[model samples]
Target chain A: MIQLIAYLIIIVLTIIFLIKMIPRKLKKSPPYTCGEPMKFEKPETVFYRTLSNILGLKKLQKLSTGNLNDYLLMIFICFMLLLIVLVMV
Target chain B: MLAPYAVPLLICTAFALPVFKNEKLIKAIAILAIFLSLSFVLSSSIEVFNSGTKVFAVSGFKAPFGIVMVLDKFSSTVASLILFLSLMIAAFSSKLVKERVKEFYTLLLLGIVGSLGIVITGDIFNMFVFTEIMNIATYALIGFTAKKEGLEASFKYLIIGSVSAVLMLLAISLLYSHVGTLNMADIISRIDTNDIYLKTIFIMLILSFCVKIAVFPFYVWKPDVISGSLEPVAAFFIGVMTTTTVYVIIRIFYTILGIYYSTWFSIIAIVTMIVGSFLALLQKDIKRILAYGSISQLGYIFLAFSTGLAFQGMYHLVNNAIIEVLLFLSIGTMLMHKKMMEKISMYAFLLGALSLIGIPPLSAFFSKFFIITGLLEKNLFIYAIISGLISIVTLLYYMKIYFMLKQGEKKIYWPIIILIIAVLLLSFVPVWLQIFKGVEVDLLARNEYVSEVLRP
Candidate 1:
């Protein structure tokens, strides 16, 4: 319990220090945009879109279009693949 | 004695809740019942850890003939954890849920009862019954908001969940036909591990539960369900519901079937981790991101279990539950108050996200550490490296949420405060309680569980 308390104290102190020391202006700046105002897309959108394109996961994501029939087909295909793999092993 | 009463007490309370028209009274009854149930589970778990396994046969019928509830170190701990999460969610929901208060509490109580039954019961057929009960309650709860999206998500889940239930029942029937018994211990003692028919049965069972836990190819419906439901209900699904399903998988594969490792399951786990993390990166909705995040976390737990690290798997399971619930409830509170742009909520969200990313000195960090070490010990260097990479991916997505957060009014939510404290205190569980040693033993020692259940 003493060790736990010590760890907790360290964590609390670290968080407080970081919060106090960081400049408020820096902390509040909108990420990935210049100081000048312009139309800005969400950083996550840009990052993930590039990553997905690089990885070619766009096709996979398209397959998961929230359509019930597509979901059922995916389930069937996956189950069959798993069944075959396990049975062979 | 008190252990057997926990499920029954909740059932009785659920049935009695509809009689009270007053919402406040109904909420009080529901919370009190869960609190009392949690107490019973805690007392029982303490006794179980000290004295070994305890079995309670229904109506004095012996095991292998009638239903029995086994409170080993593993089940008791899981039951206690489930009840504790339920209690916290119930309390949090007291103010969040507005429509059909009686029905909401009733379904919640029933869901708790089903989750408890799944963990505690020793009969395979009884487990199927409990799974249905749990799934039905969840179906209703998901649609409780009565919105178009919520209704559609609930309907889709109902179709998928019912199909899985049918597969589970069929698997149970096949096992019964092969072994001529429904008791887990009895089947373990009498069955052959290398038989082709038995292997098929095991696969069917695994696939059904894989859907429930939202593994790789089966996880598509989960984000919709989480995004459509109320925040507290979504938290329940992520924290209690999925955790209990994982427990069922562990119990069946490790304790009953006596299969310690599987290559295929490891492959599935790795794919699940990659898919869930990458998908989460693309999501803009907070709940959708969390939904995929949880799927990624479950993959880590599955990887541990499949690699024969039951202790690490169970440790990560507990950590994942606490961290996910903390995130869901805190975010839920922010949405409820229309304070999504608050700095306090952002801080709370960061705490959970960092923990999920396996930052040092946090509870998940230790579990992830144990899992990677265990993987290395088994000479699974490739799996270890993939797990590490997934952590980086986890951090990237969570950082996306961090940067998206904006500053506004800072208001405190008591449930979020309590949960944040819980997440912090979880780091001490392994050192302070020292119960994981006993749970590991209980998981690995198949004969001990078998003998205890079958003892006259």
Candidate 2:
């Protein structure tokens, strides 16, 4: 049981550290080649404005990215292995 | 009675390390911990030499019902090697480890604990767990130096290591569904009862080992890690840890799975031998050169294990451990360019490389002689010829490194003088005595290892 506690603590701390270490991702700048705007911007200005209005960073994040609760489960597995060994003890 | 002391003492010492503020005190404790561990391993080896196998159940529970530690000729011998190198590394790296001293020693001891657990435990699941513990410590240790390449190598190692862990776990899960027993001996004794599952398990287990050892195509990550790391711990980690995995493969497959299943395992052995040697020849950097050399060396070890020459394989194991560690310690020092340390590591490499390539009379020569002779006795004349050819090729690489070192720009650190002379003495004395005294190590025919382990 104590071993399980220890393993859990280690997992929690490692996850916290790893997250802090991962560099923040930034959006890509429009291509600098040729003076033409990406995807005919003048022709699609209205559509772009509509899309921008509906699909901001928060909306894009909601659509394109999601959390998996990986940290919680990682801790759970570590605790489980620790529990198994402790029980064997 | 001494079984628990190995793990618990290390644990106690590591846990208590934080309370001690003085670096000198921690170094003393680290050295003390490994020395005491070495003493126990040595004593256990003596006991096993006297008897046959030492089997003890944990907490007084019997085998199959509770966890068991088997101190056979095999495990005891490996343990002794582990302690021998580890004690030396602990003593040598003591004053040198500057980063996170407490954590460093703690992880090192923990890594040894995991290795010991992996060797001693009869449970396969426990082996997986111990391997993970070991991987974590080693991965962290690789990054401990805080160098850019060190971090990169550690990350690469982490991903690959994690995959191996998963593969092993999956293999274990599949194995348990059929065998329903985790005790290695129990599994071994009952293995012949199934046919289809037997082969499947062999493939799984072999993949696990090949992945772990990084043999042939699998051996790429090691060079980057070994060559890049500033920590001497990487030297022992490569030297002893990889050796343990190969030994474990032999013990698990041939000893546990029985010879009927293992007879055909030599193909990969031969392939690893050829490929490892081929890559070993093409390296320019000092460490990478030795890295491939270790791979090729693993080839001979695989040959012995596959041929069922357990004792011979083990003799090779010890020889490989000794020669490589000696060479690396010196070479690692040379890489540091501490004046005489430069000449010393290369000179040690020259003599050690001869031993490694199996020239007459050196320790490794005897090991290769046994394997090749064991091969001829098995009537695998082709393998004997191939092994001989590879040894010649390996010798060329050794000579290449020799010439390079002999020709390199002058560096004058002389602590390496003592080390060089030591390697010279070690290389010359034993072989010279054996030749003059006509001391004979009777060459075992094929299947020599099988009979030795089964003998009494």
List per-prediction Cα lDDT, in the order shown: 0.85, 0.64
Q: How close to the true structure is residue A79 of candidate 2, measured as C-alpha lDDT?
A: 34
Give me the TM-scores of chain B across the candidates.
0.96, 0.86
Residues B156-251 of candidate 1 have per-residue lDDT tens digits of 899889878988999999999999999999999998988988988988898998988789989998998899898888988999999899999999
Superposed model 1: Cα runs more than 4 Å off: A1-39, A42-45, B1-19, B339-344, B407-410, B429-433
Q: Whole-model lDDT, candidate 2?
A: 0.64
Give the TM-score of each candidate.
Answer: 0.91, 0.73
- What fraction of the real A-B contacts shows up in model 2? 0.00
Error of 1 at B274 (Å): 0.7
Residue B336, model 1, lDDT: 66
User: Where is the poorest 10-residue window by lDDT in model 2 chain B?
Assistant: B437-446
Per-residue alpha-carbon lDDT of candidate 1 for residues A1-89, written as tens digits (9 for 90 to 100): 99999999999999998787655534565445466654455545677779878887766667568888778778878877887779778
Each model's iRMS = 1.6, 19.0
